[model samples]
Target: MTLLDQPTGPSASVWPPDAHGPRRDPAPLLPDPEPFRMLGTPAADKLDPELLRDLYRRLVLGRRYNQQATTLTKQGRLAVYPASTGQEACQVAAAAVLRETDWLFPSYRDTLAVVSRGVRPVAALTLLRGNAHHGWDPKAHRTAPLCTPLATQAPHAVGLAHAARLRGDDVVALTMVGDGGTSEGDFHEALNFAGVLNAPVVFLVQNNGYAISVPLSKQSAAPTLAHKAVGYGISGRLVDGNDAAAVHSVLTEAVEHARSGRGPVLVEAVTYRLEAHTNADDATRYRTSDEVVAWRQRDPLAVLERHLREHDLIDDAGVAAAAEAAEELAAEMRAEFHSEPELDPMSLFEHVYAEPTPQLREQADLLAAELAAEADPR
Candidate 1:
């Protein structure tokens, strides 16, 4: 069977299938490997109008967010930013698939996902701006701090999912990571525990060709990243990450599979990073401009916008409206970041423990006294 003919979810009896089905001759691994595509296809005609419009709006907004965040880093407002320029679909789909009670464990690069899930745009950039406190609280947002350590959030998501299941709560935890993170020991251990405990968790591996300067070819010898799931005895699914409709469809199925108490799921979203790893890294040093230009042809926003227009799901006015909304958000973020934040000197001692020790109390007193003396020095 052809790659497009392969089943898109765990419902297929084959359980796990090679992205290329079964090829008799040795086949060169295609980076995309005929990923399950929906937009620009017949399947797109079946999508709900509401869903299409929502995806369209988010796609436009996500791209704008990435662009603006990268600009902030250039202006020195943000210490650094890992833009999701070409990977908006994965971010939007992952956020759209979860329930409100669910939790999201995002790697540092997933600011788009966090913002798409109702997080305030400026608050989402706090960590990247090198702020002392994450602008948003974890419990209030149901999101974890943007994790900088590679693959560490994997085990945290599993522990939360397993504990929620044991507490009789219908909660699912979804975590995201880049292609390089798969090589980390934490990733394997988390998947192992998630499979054994049947935790209600979903892993979205955005295989965007490279893990910083390192390419996937150097990270693993596996045929496909999705294939990693079989070793842990879980279901695996693949989709064209740039195709927002396909991404939304696949992620929804995976999340439901976990939520229904079936088992954990691993979804590999084959995509590309249109920009460098971060503002600090130079992508041209490693990759050619021509390669980036080719990926630009499949930009997620354009794909979804075209589908929405063809299906009569969104009109020109709707498109303009989405762009206007995104622009407004970008402006607001710029205005907010231009102002200096009031940092309390005492916050360093807070949240470290439920109660402060005598040593800590003594230090707090000394710090307060110093502040008081400065204020009265005239």
Candidate 2:
């Protein structure tokens, strides 16, 4: 049989059905691979209309927030910022399925996910503005601080899951990392430990293809990153990351699995990064324009918005209103950042340790004296 007409079954032999003679060529590896199964398929039609509308609003807000943050950084308001322009679907969908009781360990680019989960916009900005050690307390909201060091949050999530298991808390830890981060040793270590300990955690890897200019092909030789979990002896899934509904469904299943004490699962979200790595990095330097154009067609916000409109959950006017409201909120947040009190350099040592060291005390005193000396003596 021709390659196009080859039987897709376990019984089908690598030799063609009509091959009456000895095989002239070596068989190709992995001919009839199992079809990629998506989680949450059965639940698509069961989503509430109100939740769909809320998802749309959150998507728009996330897009607007990233845009404004980029503009602000360019205008000298922020030190540096990461943009989650094209990955809203993964963030929003996964966030929507989470309970407030669930724990979240997010990277810096996951501001959209945090915001969707009720993190105040201004509070998130506090980290970017160098005003707070962390955006919010993890114990208070069950969300960890934004991890700037790549892939470091994965193991932290594992620790949280271990703690929850010990305390007999029915909470799951959902940790997110980029496709590029999967190369880090921390990522592998976390996955292994979670599997061995049967930790209640979900590893969500947003595979946007390029890890700061290094393409996914260079990052791994595995056919699919989700397959990495097989070595760790855990469940793994690969999903269409651009489809918010699909993401939501898969994450809901994963969360349920963890809550039911099924151990850990790894989800590889096959998506793309639409914008540059940051406002600073130039995508044109490495990626082709054709690639950007192709991924642009799969924009998650546009896909979800279309889905909502077709379902009649929202109208054009409703979308417009959401955008307007998001703009107002962004403006208010910007104003709040501007009005924040100046950082006290002396206060930097205040929370460094449980008890202050003599050297730290002396440094603090020196800083206070310098500030006092610099004050106007009118």
Number of clashes recorded per candidate:
0, 0
Residue range 1-378, candidate 1, lDDT tens digits: 997798865476453356545422212112244678988778877878898888888888888888888888888999989999999999999999888899999999999999977899789988788766576887777898888999999999999999999999989999998999999999999999998899999999999999999989999999899888878878877789999889999889889999999899888999999999998898988889999999999988887787777767888799899999999988988888888788888887887669999999999999999999998996
**What Cα-based lDDT does every candidate model obtain?**
0.87, 0.81
lDDT of 1 at 179: 90
Flag clash pairs in model 1.
Answer: none
Please, what are the lDDT tens digits per residue for candidate 2 over residues 280-378?
898899999999999998898888787777767789799999999889878976786676576767767855689999998999899888888889554
**Which 10 successive residues of model 1 have the least lDDT summed?**
23-32
Candidate 2: lDDT over CA atoms? 0.81
lDDT of 1: 0.87
Question: What lDDT does candidate 1 reach at residue 130?
Answer: 78
lDDT of 2 at 352: 68
